[model samples]
Target: MEGNDLQRDGVARVLLWGAVLLAVAAGMRYGLLENGLLPRDCLAPGSPVAPCAFKTALVQSFLHQRLGWVSLVLGGLAFATAGRRLAWAGWLSGLSGLILYSYEPAAVGAMLALLVLARPRGEQRH
Candidate 1:
């Protein structure tokens, strides 16, 4: 029973983290990237505007699909090693990438992470 409870708690935490990351990614996409003044202000070279550099970096990351690749890698690691921490990392990155315009690999990574996460704790190798 205690083990079951621990598993439930771990699952809940993973879900909560995914939700929070999704929310943040959504906010970044819709709030700052799409319909916000940041992009416009960032057009000027060396704008020195607050958040301009940060937004640009994020945009670059999105364009390059860095998050999606990282998530996929982490998911593969988790799947190969059955490591709980790696699974959590994959899940979080997958959720973020899904929201940040990296859906293809993100979906596969998220599926792998979920599979690892769903395993019983006792059955997990790590």
Candidate 2:
């Protein structure tokens, strides 16, 4: 039916968006950071270069497991509420956290987000 098609479309969109986010995160973590494409001086304090500043910000985000905690919190909220937006946010955050060296809580968060996302559209509503 039309409703089923709509549901499928929504799910597909969410999945596609998540995939794109994951790919970008992987590129930033591996191609740039792990691959050492970024010079060490790029991360130094008070870097004047714009690109270095952006890269440094990305690097700092994963430090101290901050991304993992953020992913966990967002995933928990999405699980508790089953809101589409929250679920998408949690899924994206989880994927990024996992790729950026925050796998522990990120794994749990990703699982929670997947669970919410897998539920039937009708059941997603409170």
Candidate 3:
């Protein structure tokens, strides 16, 4: 029974790492798609950015990308770890990653958090 619990814990950690990576990729895609773009013709070398494009930003796009990257590294650590405590660490990272990184499209947010919570946080065999 103990062995089985450890095995399950191992699996959970991996899932959390996967979620972190997914969040990073999603953040990048969204950030690039929505950026400040000057009008096609209203550029003179250092012209101000157009209003329509600039206003499109939600600030979250920029922040989420950075947060996502950090979360991924933390997730990786969690994945490599084999203990219940580490699993919780990964879960926390995933939840925070989801909160800070997820934007209007909340599906990813919920998914990331769920994955972290469900993933195997292994046990340290003493």
* Model 3: per-residue Cα lDDT over 1-126, one tens digit each: 244453454555545565676576556445443342323333457555654344334334346464445445544554455334444544544454554444333333333344544543353435
For all candidates in order, the CA lDDT equals: 0.81, 0.80, 0.46
- Highest lDDT model number: 1
TM-score of each: 0.83, 0.81, 0.32
Candidate 2 clash pair list:
none
Q: Is candidate 1 or candidate 3 better by lDDT?
A: 1
* Model 2 worst lDDT window (10 residues): 1-10
Off by over 4 Å in 1: 1-9, 41-46, 124-126
Which residue pairs clash in candidate 1? none
Best by TM-score: 1
Q: List candidate 3 segments past 4 Å from native.
A: 2-64, 83-86, 102-126
lDDT of 2 at 91: 85
lDDT of 1 by residue, 61-100 (tens): 7687888888899999999988878999899889989999
